[model samples]
Target: MNHRHLGRSGLMVSEIAYGNWLTHGSQVEKEAALACVRAALEEGITTFDTADVYAATRAEEVLGEALAGERRAGLEICTKVYWPTGPGPNDRGLSRKHVFESIHGSLRRLRTDYVDLYQAHRYDYATPLEETMLAFADLVRQGKALYVGVSEWRAEQIEAAAPLARELKIPFVSNQPQYSMLWRVIEDQVIPASERAGLGQIVWSPIAQGVLTGKYRTGQPLPVGSRAAHEDGARFIAKFLTDDLLGRVQQLQPIAQEAGLTMAQLAIAWVLQNRSVSAAIVGATRPEQVRENVKAAGVKLDDGLMRRIDEVLGEAVVRDPARTASPEKRP
Candidate 1:
């Protein structure tokens, strides 16, 4: 897989990062999850992304076991905080106590001494920004995390934090957002703000939660065991399930055929076309799905093909910057 420098940092991550979000602990069996990680490694993927709250933190344990024998130096392991890992009030947000305590739990679960990057899963409205950055700063000083980033934060939120990160002298490198052919919320505001702040994007849901894969068709039942068929997965993907959107997604099949790419590959390559994107995160339930996504790593779609995609998916894209948001109150 091709690699890119995350933001202006010297650390390089595989362009196609293997992520275990909904699949590792909740959707797929442990053996299946491990097999997918092996497939990723076999395809030369060196970066893996997970979070402390995913599947109540079981995802990290699964990933830890999967990467147990590998040379840690060769892998870029990233995880996040800012979500409730327990029922206690202290269990959530980016308060000093939570951030400090969360990293230890993450480290223990991931089986790593220090993560290459530790990110805020979402902006913490409840905690003071200073307390949050200071906590991350301390982790860096203590050698528990090498770099820090935020996910799904607004442009103004990033702008607000940039100077604080600079003041603290921590390596603030990336913002993980959901960006796909169908989800373009980050393009107008977040990308420009991140560019100014020296933050690259590690985008998730590049295939629009599997909508852009062209598997969910108009006037058809949801695939037997597809993401849309699962209760929790269905909620995140519901917005892209309209007949109008599904019909537009279907029209891209010929474009994929012409480019000798699968619908999923086409979706991934389309996202990487944006220079601000450092990496695209892909999650899989099966090993072959991991293999299929890595093929898009170095593939580039020419201008003509890109235009065709825009034309076909016209008006179906969600570009309103207001959609890039975090909860007003911590959950």
Candidate 2:
């Protein structure tokens, strides 16, 4: 796998990262999940991204077990904070208490002394930004986290935090946003702001929750055992379930064929076309899915193919910068 520097940081991550978002503990069986992790390792995927909130934190444990025998130095494990992990008030957000406490839990579960990257799952409006940055700074100094990042944070929020991160000497290196052919919300503002702040994007949902994969066909019932068929997974994917979107997605079939790539690989390569994107995170329920998507790692789409994608997805794309929003309040 090709590696890229995460933002301006010296850290190098696999261009195709394995992420356990909805798959590990809840969607797929343990054996399948382990096989998928193994597949990623075999494919040279060095980075693994997860969150404290995913599958009630069981995903991290599953990933930890899968990577137990590997050389830790060769891996980049990333987990996030700022989601409610318990009933208590201190269980969530990017407050100093939660940030510190969450890192310990994450480390214990991941079976690693330190994560390569510790990200804020979402910007915490309730907590002071300084408190969050200071907590991250402390984690870096304490050797519990090597780098810091944020996910789905707006441009203004990133601009607000960059100076403080610099002041605190925290290595804020990445922004994990949802960027896909159908979702260009990050392109207009987040990318520009992050480029200025020296942050690269580790984008999730690059296939639009599997929409761009063309598996969800127009006028067809939800595919059996697909993400949309699963209750927990359906929530994030419902927005792209409409007939109109599926029709637009189908228009990419010719583009994928001309490029000699699968719809999934084409969608992934589309996101990596942006120089600001350091890596594209992919999750899999089966090992073969892991093998297929990684082909996009070093592949580049030509200008004509990219234009065809834009022409096919025109008007169906969501590009408004204002739509790159965070939660109004802590969940």
Candidate 3:
């Protein structure tokens, strides 16, 4: 495993990190999630990422249960805030009041004293940036969090954060964004801004939520018990899983084959190929998935392979959220 400093924080993070997103409190059983966590650690992946909104917050509880006592000391646990938890008006966002309250719940759920990196899950237009930055600084001062970050924020948002952190003297170490072979939106804005702000990038869904993994091929019915099978929030995935795009993705399979790598490995390797990225976060429902995804760390994408992938994707298929409809209704 390779390591990189998390921006200016100077904390060395593995090039591949484990994230509990759709799988932790939804698809994978507790024993399986625990085993996957162990597998990541054994492979030298020290950072664990989770969000407060994942599976309605049960993901944190499961991770906490799995990493209780001295076992918890072996890893760096990271979690995020934002997204509504309930009916209360104050239930979410990056307000100082909420940031202070949310971390307490997160700490209680994670069964840990402090998070290695506590991120604002998204940009909170409602809260003042100063309030959020100051709240994060307080968390560090109180020893509730070691460092602070943001996720899925636009480039300008990262730029906006730097001055606030500098004014408050708080360390803004990283930003987690979605970047993959199929999705290069970060290259447009987020990547450059993070670089300017000295915020190390950690990309989530580096496989584009398994689309680039060659799992959802053209003309195939959605796989049973797969994320494509997720009826609740995967309708957007179905929209872009078009025959034309799958054909394009399949055309690039030879590139991975010629390079002696799996499509998943190739996709992840491409994301980490950027020196600006501190890590690429992988979501695994099974322990075996962790084993498979981690191999991407050192696969290395050469210029010829990159050009071939671009030849297949062309300009890359960009999506408009407005074009997608609601997810499949639960039975």
Q: TM-score for all predictions?
A: 0.99, 0.98, 0.93
lDDT preference between candidates 2 and 3, better one: 2
Candidate 3 residue lDDT tens string, 34-145: 9988788778787888987888989999888876764655577899998877678788888887888889999999988899899998888888888889999999888898
* Cα lDDT listed for each candidate: 0.94, 0.93, 0.82
Q: Tens-digit lDDT track for model 2 on 189-303?
A: 8999999999999999999888888889877788999999999989989988888889988988988999999999999998998999999999999999999999998898999
| Clashes found in each candidate (C-alpha, N, C closer than 3 A) | 0, 0, 0
lDDT of 3 at 196: 85
Worst 10 residues of 3 by lDDT: 322-331
Q: List pairs with backbone clashes in candidate 3.
A: none
RMSD of each: 0.9, 1.0, 4.0
Lowest lDDT block of 10, candidate 1: 322-331
